[model samples]
Target chain A: MTERLTLALDAMGGDHAPAMVVRGAEIARTRYPQVDFIFFGRESEISPLLDRMKKLKAVSRIVHTDEAVSSDDRPSVALRNRRSSSMRMALDSVKEGAAKATISAGNTGALMAMAKFVLKTLPGVDRPAIASFFPTLRGETVMLDLGANVQCDARNLVQFTVMGNAFARSVLGIKEPTYGLLNVGSEELKGHEILHEARQELSGLNLPGRFHGFVEGDDITKGTVDVVVTDGFTGNVALKTAEGTAKLYTEFLRGTFRSSLLASIGYLLARPAMRKLLKRVDPRRYNGAVFLGLNGITVKSHGGTDALGFAHAIGVAVDLARNGCLETMGRDFKAVDRSTPDEPAQAAAV
Target chain B: MTERLTLALDAMGGDHAPAMVVRGAEIARTRYPQVDFIFFGRESEISPLLDRMKKLKAVSRIVHTDEAVSSDDRPSVALRNRRSSSMRMALDSVKEGAAKATISAGNTGALMAMAKFVLKTLPGVDRPAIASFFPTLRGETVMLDLGANVQCDARNLVQFTVMGNAFARSVLGIKEPTYGLLNVGSEELKGHEILHEARQELSGLNLPGRFHGFVEGDDITKGTVDVVVTDGFTGNVALKTAEGTAKLYTEFLRGTFRSSLLASIGYLLARPAMRKLLKRVDPRRYNGAVFLGLNGITVKSHGGTDALGFAHAIGVAVDLARNGCLETMGRDFKAVDRSTPDEPAQAAAV
Candidate 1:
């Protein structure tokens, strides 16, 4: 039998907190029988919830922590004042090698700051990027630098590509995933100088995945590439815009069905098919946002997600740890020849 | 009767040029009988189409031009070599006061470069922005810097707010539109220093629209503000991403209906409601992307759009010109105190 994989959880992080966290762990336990969890939060709040989850309690250990990071805490403030916060303690477990991965649904900025401090960045990596999976026509595609490094240079973008490529392979199980740089237009001269420079550098490298050159924004949902690489600023905006649009589209659909009694009856007949469609595009299926380029595996769950969504985040951490994502990234980075990289540094500085 | 508004058209622009352009003009003539057109292209090709459209022929005059801007031409290359091109000639008509506005469905970069060179920017306006109307839950919202100025500072963004506010007032007929700066998060300390400074400056101004402070990406579709202001790069990415997401969502819906025979029958029963829904989200309804801050009004039609879409673009230009959008913007700019503007210039430079 394979050895059990341990994952650290910040039980007090998300909106629904101890209840959702405990229930999500229970659900995740059923899926990943060989995985154990180390919960960091107030035991008093978590113990009663754990009592309700017998299967999760069987393989769980709780570390009492009264202090927890508030959603409003700034990254700097959290780092200085909330050293013993649940989010920090969870990251600490990963740093101490007690857990293979850590999952948190805390204040994003504060979590990123703490994760960077506790786990540090991989060698030769300037900053860690937040990577997440997006549902596409061709199944799923991964995008990186969602909101991590806002103003990235060519070097930072290239690094993102490498990290994204590695994550797609390790987590998604893609044999040889293709990646593209997201830009305004597909033309070479369309975007700023930094994008052009990054494209040049990426094209010259004998990377693992095939670099599909430049891709426009529409290509993200078209599944034009396995991985879409962009700076944190644009990536974040695109992601949030897509989410808002999706919500708006669904609302419009609901309003259309409720417009008439006949349409409502028609909706009833299509309910089963609609359920399948909803499941296919469910946000919970794409909950976890992995912090790529970090020394240890770190996955950030959406703060407003429910138990099912939190469970999916746990699954993402488990998959990454089991697939040895960090080791794969290390190997990929070392394979790249950094002999003529002065251009990227100069471009990034701008 | 009101004076006729003449709009210059680059008949040779777009993929299905001359055909789509002439046909679109014919369609637009039916919508706005008071508008006349000065078509710039090969008279030999357009005369026949015009002959088929008697009403359009009555109000239109063809100005023959042998040259035209190619879709593949670089902006700088087109500006230098394509001086007598149809696109250039069309803009010339607006510059010479022959037409109140000009509309093109050619290369966006080339059109912007030529338009800027022909019509100087408004007073206190550093650059012109591409503004478009997006369908939202709260009807329609205007967004600027869609793909114009790639890198914008606090000052450029503030200027965008003024232009967008004017566009919403004059074109959209909103008495007091609410505007916001798009950012990664709604928190005051979320984005870069430029955003913070822009927010500070915007809050201090007694602008026409209510400044909604900071808004996240989702706020655009939620219609949290009447005018969504962002830099070109982020705005462009967000726009395309939303488009892609809409397409994906529609495809998912179609797939759902086809998944089962019962679902297909239900779709048939709800066909009328579905048609109404389709009409609401149709891209043709929002075809024109206005170039704001230019001395002369200019609208860019989607290059790949059909006659209906092209007609809508002409309608946008006509509305902007008839409503005196330029005058509104000029008045608003004059109202702002420019004495303490060193902060904006410094922020914009970075």
Candidate 2:
């Protein structure tokens, strides 16, 4: 595990390309010396940052690609015209088995699309989902379909649930991750037909993890289930809402501390624990955007991220790769088929 | 205006019963002398609390009733069986023009059911929604359909949208409340079929507020939308997620501050500002739950609430009564015909 982790850093991607990406790569090298990185943008963009990165660790490879993927570049267009782009070539490297994983901080849609296209789906995976760990009241909750597969069908959602469970167990180290459908309510008949249908489909699937019935937004915070599954729209909304509220709450708390002279001193005394908690819940620390259901490990860092964020993304990729996530997922899917082929109509009833 | 605000309090319902109800009434009376109260419940439950209430404030009347509605009781059954129950009778007081509004910390379904039965829907209003205000990062956002109509059609959602718009304006004093349909994304085409239909309906309707397209859960915290409209299930999820996350965040902050000595001192200095924020965002201060789509003003406080929470509910009721909320809603509904004069296809489509 301490051995070198070769990561193809898509330096040309992200808003603060090259600089932040290069810095993040350097950080990853120093903190995790076992992890070696390749800078994948144009030589001009990567050269200046080389000095800063030298302070942390030396880079082994520099795949010079003149092409860069702008945040605004259309995904299809990027894939078509910029086949030689750094992001594309980085994935090509991963495909060629040069790197264990490829990391990018570019347009999520484009990255996911290209990643899916290049990596392809593993056996039995209809599609890949993006699952992330959120800081909730109870504990970390894994939510899927944050921005992948927006208009998903019942089968799509059921698969999302399966992938999510596999993810929580593999990455988060949870055993038998509890899976729950994210809906407006818990009642079997409460939400729309899709979720209702999904509930039925899930009921009969004989999934590897425990099906904890349906959960709502608050349920995410309650930690009622380990893996919460939903379509990208609702899941994305829930994730962003939690993130925004966390930031807002932090801002308000700091201001409250500074308002009064005495309270200001109290805030000073409480800074250590407070900062710890803030960072604990900071969305950036959990900076991982996993392309689930894919044949290979592709992690997308936040586009507007800092050096530290990219390092975290690499950490996530390392975890996924070492954990045999794909193999485990295939096993889970096989379990579904082997356990219950009948799938009684009444078995899926809400 | 404060002097004229009188509220009828339901004593028999809720999880805590007469003690919390009597305590809440006393607290409201002490805080707002303009506020008078009439307690309706079993005489046995009210007699003992009269002297204690007198110690806090003067009680004008106590209407004796033997029936009580359980939280799980069906709305219709509760409404029928509890013909003279405290909740129904209190609502009757509001309908008969004796009190500005009736407040219940009881079964939410029964409260809405009885209110609708006795007070009736406002002209042109097809359905009523449950609405509450959330303190967001920017300022505040109003969310509706917390749990009113579980299985809402596009039409019901439209009505919820209408109610949310008026509530934001009247209660929050917001001008041209920015309305957003809570969905996964901002795209016009994204969402469940009902939501998709409602999106079109909302876009086409010439309403009082500005429809700023579809707002996601994060938009609530971003302060992009003044009114976040959703079905009861989604609304409840969003609201509860906000609530649970806020609590968890504060808890984490508290733990962080308490972890070490130096940070503890920092917490002291920042205590005033933090206290101000905690006060402003405190859930209890914004406890009153308004039942929209009713002919008269009504508020549902949390079943397990204190005097402060009840006082907030009274404050909400006072605002609605003073602002002619019922009349405004009636006028808005009049502008949009509830019953279709034609277009059977439209109704079916809706």
Who wins the TM-score comparison? 1
Best by DockQ: 1
Fraction of native Cα contacts kept in each candidate?
A: 0.65, 0.69
True lDDT of residue A28, candidate 1: 95
lDDT of 2 by residue, B1-350 (tens): 44567678898766777887777777776766676788889888777877765654464578888877777777878877888888889999988988789989888878888898999988666778889878876777888888776667888888888888888887788868889788775222246888889988888777776898787777888889898888786677677778778878777777777787787666666666667787877889879989998888889998878777877887888888877777777777766664334556777889
Candidate 2: regions farther than 4 A off: A1-3, A55-57, A73-82, A184-189, A193-209, A343-350, B1-3, B55-57, B150-157, B185-209, B265-273, B336-350
Model 1, span B1-350: residue lDDT tens: 98888999999999999899999998999999899999999999999999998888999999998999999998999999999999999999999999999999999999999999999899879999999999899989999889998888999999999999999999999999999999888231368789989999899888876999888889999999999999998888888898899889989999999999989988887778888887777788889999999999999999998899999999999899989999999988877745355657876899
lDDT comparing candidate 2 with the true structure: 0.79
Q: What is the lDDT of residue A199 in candidate 2?
A: 89
Candidate topping lDDT? 1
- Tell me what TM-score chain A of model 2 achieves: 0.92
lDDT of 1 by residue, A158-199 (tens): 989989998899989997999999988823137888988999
Chain B alone vs. reference chain B, TM-score for every model: 0.95, 0.90
Candidate 1 backbone collisions, by pair: none
lDDT of 2 at B319: 84
Summed over model 2, clashes come to: 44
